[model samples]
Target: MPPSHTPVQYTTRIHDYPLHYTEAGSGEILLLIHGSLCDYRYWRWQIPALSQHYRVVAPSLRGFWPAALRSADDSFSIAQHIRDMSAFARRLGEGRPVHVLGHSRGAQIALELACGAPQEVRSLILADPGFRIAGEAPGAPLHTTVAKLLERGEVEPALAEFVDAVNGAGTWRQMVSWFKTMVTDNAYTLLSQIREINLDVDLDRARRLQCPVLLVGGAHSPARYGSRLDRLEQAVGQARRITIPAASHGMNLANPKAFNQGVLNFLAGLRADEARPPAGIP
Candidate 1:
């Protein structure tokens, strides 16, 4: 049997809201941020695997489950998430920088954090980020379709449609009841996201990131997603790219082995570089 995915749960007040997170292992901090409609549970497969070599901290973003907001407000914006994550990371690090990993919408927040506070983040791993690049918007027809379904009081089908769009056909049905419940609990946040505008990161700011970056995507994902990764790679000079074969937008959930190995290998290489003496120093 695979190692248990349970993590030690904790909560800390970040700004105006309480952020719930799951932590495991001990070493340099590795903060994992989940995407929209997802909480800390999304990293179930990764937590146990990566915790062996690093302190893995996966936090449920503001307005996500276990603390879902009753009112929809600006508090759920990407800007707000960045602030919360920055505070969360700082608290975890105790003055040291952390390795940040984000998926989908969470990736956008991670980018903002790296750009706004380079000192707080040691590195970045963005998987199937859902955002704009170089003034181009990535199409999300499923978002609209799901919104319509939800408006008609069809929550289950809406959730199923959204999952299938990101993962693959019939993927939603395979998910456990707990996962579906969490998604349904946080489904309201999707409306806020759809109405928001001018949320995409500025490449000009992204170009200023000095930390090592590893861009991850699924080989079977839509072309727009791949293009966004390409643009992001160009913005963060020297950034590495890794594509998990036979996977879609939900690479972390669908192909956790490749996703985990890719991240672990990148981190190991970073550690190696840090230990190596500068050329000509000897």
Candidate 2:
């Protein structure tokens, strides 16, 4: 079993909202971004391990969990998330470019930040990034089903259907009680995402990023997700790929060992690259 983390909690005011976050360890900064309908705790399996080598900071995106919600007009967009993450990284890193790892929708936000504010991010690890690709309307059926179920006031069943769609059938039964509570707490946000159009990312910009990027995917994830990652890998000039076996869209929770080791290895390579001298000088 993977070691669990008891994160130190903190909140910082950003753009008229208080952003709640969890932190552990101490060293250079590493930001972990979670997907929709979840908070920083989604990265619980990762914090204790990664924090040993780097200060891991995972913040709940605005309008989720402890973070107070604002009007949709004032919050909830990829651009907004990018701004929040950039500001969070800057304040936490004290002007140093911090390392970032994002999963699912959070991955889309991370890519946007790396492209829009490259100077704020040192390197990136994107696991099953949730972005529309090749004009594919991924998750539409599930989203519609969940939205209808939520409309009919069947919150639990709605959540179950949604969870099963992402994590595989029967996963909801295996999920911890608190995990279910977490999802239920964010039920509204999950419903809103069905119609949200703010997370669309620009691959043209992503391809231009000069920093090292590791694109991760789960071996058993839906084909659409794998296909999108493949397209993204091909788009990014400095990208590498890794697939965690026996895993699905929710790879971090499904296979933390492979996910954690993959990240550690990527960070190690980045360090090695920095240690290498100028090519002509050697």
Candidate 3:
């Protein structure tokens, strides 16, 4: 098994909301953004390995576990998350650009950050980015069904359906107890997520990103994610794609060794490129 270490916890105020996060190791900052039904804990398998080279900071988005919603009026949309994270990055990096790695829904927010606030991001890594691309056919209303189940208080069933919908059939059953607990903790967020509009990304927006991008995918993941990555690769000028074998939606957790190595190699190459002298330099 890969090395695992407990990360130090901290809370910071962003836009008047207290955001909770975990930090480990030290170096260039690497902000981790998790997807649906997840929080900072989702990066448990990542912090230990990646932290050796970079300061890994994983924040639980507002409304997720450990971050209570202030009131029923508190917002929970992608735009709000993007704003929170942009501010969070600025505060954490202290005016320096930080490396960013986001998974699933978090990947969409990371992309938006890279596009909207280019100066704050040095490079971007997206794993199975979960967003509808403009012109793609509408997917089934899985979120709607999950929301209904939550409304009925069938939280487990609702999460199971969603886990299977994205990761593949029987994924929920195979999930470890800890993972299940994490999912259950953030179940209510699905209700708010389903209500959000404009979750789709367009090629023009993807084209606006100015940093290097690494797209990671699970070899066994559903075709939809692969298709989205395809479109993104075509749009982004400096994008690279890789797939982890024997994994699905949760590739990092499923195959951490390969996932970690791939990410580190990408970051290392970026450093090497930076070290190389400009062309025609003596």
Candidate 4:
């Protein structure tokens, strides 16, 4: 069994919202971000492994499980989450550049923060995140959609459908396994926006990355995904991509060994690259 993860909790205010985060180990800062419907618990594997050589900071994203809800405007917009994360980095990064890892929706948020504050971020690992169209009907708000789903018991099914590759039957079954009851309870309560409330990032702006980057995904991910990471590699100009063969959409949970090793290997190479002297220097 993997050693238990004992995280030290820290509560701080970012803008007007209260931020709840966990910290452990001591070295260069390594920030971890979780996707929608998940709290920091999602990074349990990487947190302990990475912490051995880096200071780990995992925050419960606002509008997600362990964080406070600030707006009825589907509080989990990419912009607000990015802003909040940037604020957290500004306040907690403590003058040292930090490395960041984000999964799913969290990956989108991390991308925005790194773009907006390049100096604060030394490297980034973005896992399996892409665009999502969440709204329909101009006048019908996203929260209204959530309410309708609540009435029709469609929420879990909808969420489960998201991981069809993992769930053999389809959405409802997948949702039951992915969201679970407790996670669903929290998810249904936080109203969402008709569309992503913040930044709109897809393959378009991937070329703008200013730091070392690692694009991560599952080797067995659904074939429908068109290798966005491959596109990112071309655009980023200095980024690398790695897929975990033993994993699926959710690599961290499904194949922790491969995920941890992939991350550690990449981080080690990054540190080595930085430590190496200018090529051609005597």
lDDT string, candidate 4, 107-220, tens digits: 888887788888888899988864332221122143455545555767664445434533234434534343474356455433564355332465445567778999898876
lDDT on C-alpha atoms for all candidate structures: 0.84, 0.82, 0.89, 0.69
Worst 10 residues of 2 by lDDT: 66-75
Any runs in candidate 1 off by more than 4 Å, and if so which?
A: 1-6, 137-144, 168-170, 174-178
RMSD, one per candidate, in order = 2.2, 2.4, 1.9, 4.4
Q: In model 4, how large is the Cα lDDT of residue 22?
A: 82
Tell me, by TM-score, which candidate is best: 3
C-alpha positional error of residue 137 in candidate 3 after TM-score superposition, expressed in Å: 1.3
lDDT of 3 by residue, 1-282 (tens): 133445567999999989999988899999999998899889988888899999999999989988643223248988899999999999989999999999999999999999899999999999998988888887898988988888888889999999999999999999998899989888888888876533688789779888999999999999999999988988887899899999999999999999999999999999999999999997
Residue lDDT tens for model 2, 1-282: 134435667999888778999888888889999887899878878887888888889999988886533223345666678888888988987878999998988988888888888999999989998777546664456777787787787889988998887767888888887689778877767655755543366678887998899999999987867888888888987899999998898888878889989999999899998899988996
Candidate 1 lDDT over residue span 5-47, tens digit each? 4556798899967788888889999999999899988888899
lDDT of 1: 0.84
**Best candidate, lDDT-wise?**
3
Candidate 1 Cα deviation (angstroms), residue 276: 0.8
Q: Residue 64 error for model 1, in Å?
A: 0.5
